[model samples]
Target: MLKQFGCTKFATGEDFDTGELFVQFEHRGRMVSLIASSKGYAAAWLKENPYNNRRKGTKADHEAKALEKGGTAVYSILRDWVKGQVTAIEIGMLSFESAFLSHILLPSGKRVIEHVEEQKLLEGK
Candidate 1:
């Protein structure tokens, strides 16, 4: 299964890391997960590999690599998936990039910014 999924050992931190982009399948009474990202290294390795698996080296190394590559990949995949799902549901022109860049209105009538605002208020101006 590992070979079929193009599984490779990542030299990550603290433990062995295995990245898998998997799909759930039912087999008899049990559920099976098949690696879908075997065909796409960047998708599977970059996105799903870091957090889902154990690291092989130090935590710092794992975190560094994950922060450098994993985070971006994960964000990309998640953004794409969200876009696809929302579009499928006929949500008009919802863009992940826009949401990431600007403020968005939530269903709760609250506005959320992609990044937090840090402001200091003076007692008297």
Candidate 2:
């Protein structure tokens, strides 16, 4: 079945006044060229740090814990749930705002916005 996961928008140019916008999700992604409307303004935000690099053994510990979860683990369990289905997802303006709030511009000029929203699974066809 088709599912409405979540949404995210990626700024595609240095000029914030006008640029390309990318709407992304688990099943598909879209690029909305030419951002002209003020109502849909995009603001860059910071990336979420899932792990602490300064802390030793943190990465390893997290990986080890994830492995313990096994095939039926949290990640796998979620993956298995959406194994075979025509997922149709639609992201609204709210998600776009959230994504913009979590974006950060890189030194190389590319903007990175990670993990916009918590994944939501839908059942059926």
Task: Give each model's whole-structure lDDT.
Answer: 0.39, 0.32
lDDT of 1 at 125: 70
TM-score of each: 0.26, 0.18
> Residues 27-47, candidate 1, lDDT per residue (tens digit)?
222222222222243444546
Taking all chains together, the TM-score of candidate 1 against the true structure is 0.26
Worst 10 residues of 1 by lDDT: 7-16
Q: Give the Å shift of residue 98 in candidate 1.
A: 18
| lDDT of model number 1 | 0.39
Q: Pick the candidate with the highest lDDT.
A: 1
Put down candidate 2 lDDT per residue, 1-125, tens digits, no spaces. 22444325423222323332232233235322222221122111111223467745677674443333332233333333333221311233244333333333334433343222322223237
